[model samples]
Target: MGNSKLYKGSLSTIILKLLSEADKMYGYEITQKVKELTKGELQITEGALYPALHKLEAEGVLEVEVARVDNRLRKYYKLTEKGKEETVSKLKELQDYIANMQVLFNPKFGLES
Candidate 1:
């Protein structure tokens, strides 16, 4: 993948959250969405993105639907019930991680050392 550790760690969670919001999205759409959302700050390559999608699909948290669009088959991914639950959990974890980082980096958050 060769992406940053932070992005690699949260990639699946990001995909889950996006799918949870969009109902379904194809691979390229997900990439573009991320770029748009991030104001071009982040760009996800296929090499990194597909593996995460495949892993999530294999985990039974995501389902794929293949449809013919303009005479070509496109695979759209959506969150399953388990995926929905996982999304919530992942978001919570990310939030907690951010909070912990804040506490660690900011001297005066909620505790005194």
Candidate 2:
């Protein structure tokens, strides 16, 4: 949950994009993958991760599968067909946000002087 505020709004989109790339992933795995991808700069805490996951599940954007692995039950999540479509939309939205932020903060590239 490092810098949680900075990442709060994008959590679901991040999860959806990850599930879109992978066949399935468990909660802990998702956290680790994000840490690895971000070089440990960002951490997804359970408090934030689970609620977003559940919301996506409730929205029919995700499917869950439970399996017993090493004597422990693990819940894996994958994207539904609707989630696949939503991932594209979310990605585009994120990209647009980034571009706008860059222009806003880096005035040399902005239209206004």
lDDT of each: 0.92, 0.93
Model 2 residue 12 lDDT score: 93
* Candidate 1, superposed: residue stretches over 4 Å from native: 111-113
Put down candidate 1 lDDT per residue, 1-113, tens digits, no spaces: 23578897899999999998997999999999998988888888999999999999999999999999999999999999999999999999999998889898995984763
C-alpha RMSD of each candidate structure in angstroms:
2.5, 2.3
Model 2: per-residue Cα lDDT over 13-53, one tens digit each: 99999998899999999999999999999989899999999
Which candidate number has the best lDDT?
2
Give me the overall lDDT of model 2.
Answer: 0.93
Clashes of each: 0, 0
TM-score of each: 0.93, 0.92
Highest TM-score model number: 1
* Model 1: lDDT to the true structure: 0.92
Worst 10 residues of 1 by lDDT: 1-10
Clashing pairs in 1: none
